[model samples]
Target: MFTYERKVTYSEVASDAMADVAQIVRYFQDCSTMQSESLGMGIDFLAQHSHVWMLTAWQIQVMRRPRYFEEIVTGTWAYGFDSIYGYRNFLLKSSRGEILAVANSIWILANTKTGKPERLTGEMVQGYGSEEKYPMVYAPRRIALPKTWEDLEPFEVRRSDLDTNNHVNNARYIDMALEYADPGVNIYQLRVEYKKAARYKDKIWPRIHRENNKLTVALCDKDQKVYVAVEIATDEN
Candidate 1:
């Protein structure tokens, strides 16, 4: 288990001064990157080897939201890897060691030059300590969509949204979806499934559905091809 400490910055919080869901997503993303970097398989390392990691799915359970200036510890481990995919799990805890959130993610290692998935190397597998275990377990697959959806405002992918991969960073998709979310809802859990990459100049169509305390949002292109699907559960009865 690789762990890192961080103080929730004022800018990381939303209007309530609680760390936003997107901010937690960013922490999870960074923790995984830092974990791999510790093993010498980070972005720069992999890029030098002509490879990049693409997030495919995410499942996060937020027990409690951390507030501004709160010191938190985030840790992640690569549970295992297959021919083309990697499995990871993460945990967020307060300074007192109380668990705040847990997450599961799936990623694929692709070749930059060919854009094809590259097989896992023995070192890469061993370096992450595949045997490290965590209690949270979820299938890393696409979330099923409903037959219909209510369209929300559309958003354009801005230049700042792009990462080193030239696609919108994974966390940015959550931010976009949340922009259309019901402000009254207090999300306790969220699941994000990334279907395709959206880049600069791409316009994303957002749609939302609220069923009691649960909310579902999906992002698609003008052509109706789905990009990211988000399911959220709020703290209401």
Candidate 2:
């Protein structure tokens, strides 16, 4: 029913000079993930029902991503819905409330075995605040397969990538893999698994593959172990 906002901080950026999408994903993910829990229809709730939410798709628009340390307000609330997907809207705004970026996401609560989303329960639906607005996206109109970027000779894991537990941030790996593919500006759906962890000073190689509209991005370590694997699906605007 309401949205939240925050300023853009340096720790959220990929580099000092620009506001990278990776940081944006971090900010958005944190907000959306929490919103899911607040409504009692997210992770914790799904746990009781024997399901996990997967991000099947996303739509993003960058009107004006803020520069480093710029104050911004980030807002998120449940919006629209369809038969199988729930639509969540997120917005980034200036301290004065000017919109900076907008994102629409599609998620499913699936049965782990069948991998199909069951219709959301009445309670779950109401909890998410999906009442009036419902935005529909044509998911069948898929993203074309992107050419794989088979080399990752330049990227390196910095100390900051590690968290308090001394593991690379799960989300950052998804960003690194997608960046190597350079699969155009519009990145929509991403499905990834955190197979293993890579530490600081580790040389990383990104392996990319595409089939139809789905792109597979994987980050491998010096030992050729897969630390991260992501499937990118999109329809370029």
Candidate 3:
């Protein structure tokens, strides 16, 4: 089947300075669409495929926020297939093909009732979309991770961290934004943009700088490519 693709919108951007992690997650939530497609792709093998696609984990990185009606391409294709699970990679890019974000996920097919995965069947394996280019690459859109985090500090997000998606699972920006913390100070305020999706297991480092109650934070790859810019508010109490 053809890979799913589309542009992005303003609503998809994270704007509130006091926004919660779950709010930041809406930017990448296509649950209904992705769910339908995922199961649909299971084809006749879904029930008998032996293996199931469970959301074992994910590594996601977003570079910058997409403007309303921004011409972006969202693509999802198989990254790799194992006997027990299938690894997939996703990308969001500018119309010009500039990659804005990259994400990888592992899924397993298992008995829904028993929660046990079975080996992938030939048909189950064949039905998946084509293998993604650079299947092993962790982050294709990002340049090298940040060389170093010169300054680090403490921070926090509160009830605001809870969003419509319910929990911060809408994405993991809250955790990403907090990465820069030294555990020396308590976080009082946080504001971050949703440049990309922070899927399960995506390791994000928060680079921090502070002036009294004002804090600046940026989310980056392991190498530390600053992707999301953050603003913080603190009372120092």
Candidate 4:
């Protein structure tokens, strides 16, 4: 496992004074990069080798929300890899060791020039050192959308939403999903499956399905191609 520490900054807080959901996603991004960098597969290393990794899906469960100004320890480890995907897990813990959240994710490596999935090299797999443990296990590829749902106003992607990939960042998709869920609901779990990349000026229609404490969301384009699908399980409190 690899570990890193970070403090929740004012800019990362939401109106409720808790760290924004997307901020947690950013932490995950940082930890994943840092961990991989240590094992010789950092962004620069991969770019030099003509490959880049893309997140395919996520399953995150929050036990307690981290507040603004809190210093937290974040950790991640790769548990396994297969033909085209690497399975990893992460944790967010308070200074005193309380788990704030835990997540499991799937990632795929692609050839930068071809944009096609590639199998991991033997050396790369050995370097990551599979740990075979998890905080959660989830359906990695699909997030089922309900048959009946309502669509919200379409969102236009701005320059600020794009990342180094020149497309909508994965965290931004989670933020868009959160914006469409019930405000009073405290989300305990959030699962997102990224289907396509959304670039600047792309307009996405957010569709929502709510039943009891469970919510489902899909961000799509004018042609109804889903960019991302989300599943949120909330607690009454």
Among these predictions, the greatest lDDT belongs to: 4
Per-model clash counts, in order, read 0, 8, 21, 0
Candidate 1: tens digits of C-alpha lDDT, residues 186-227: 787788998889999999998887777777889999988889
Model 2 gets an lDDT of 0.64
**Per-residue lDDT over 1-237 for candidate 3, one digit per residue giving the tens place of the 0 to 100 score:** 233455454455434222232332343345323633575653244544433344444445445445556666666666567778776666666788886655565565666556676777676566664554544334222222233345443233344544432323334554555544444343443344434334334455567666556556666556665545555444322
**Which candidate model has the greater lDDT, 3 or 4?**
4
The TM-score, computed over Cα atoms with residue i paired to residue i, of candidate 2 is 0.62
Give the winner by TM-score: 2 or 4.
Answer: 4
Return the number of clashes found in candidate 1: 0
Number of clashing residue pairs, candidate 3 = 21
Instruction: Score every model by TM-score.
Output: 0.94, 0.62, 0.49, 0.95
Which parts of model 4 have CA positions greater than 4 angstroms off? 135-137
Candidate rank order under TM-score = 4, 1, 2, 3
lDDT of 4 by residue, 35-94 (tens): 888877888899888888889998888888899899999999999999878888999999
Ranking by lDDT: 4, 1, 2, 3
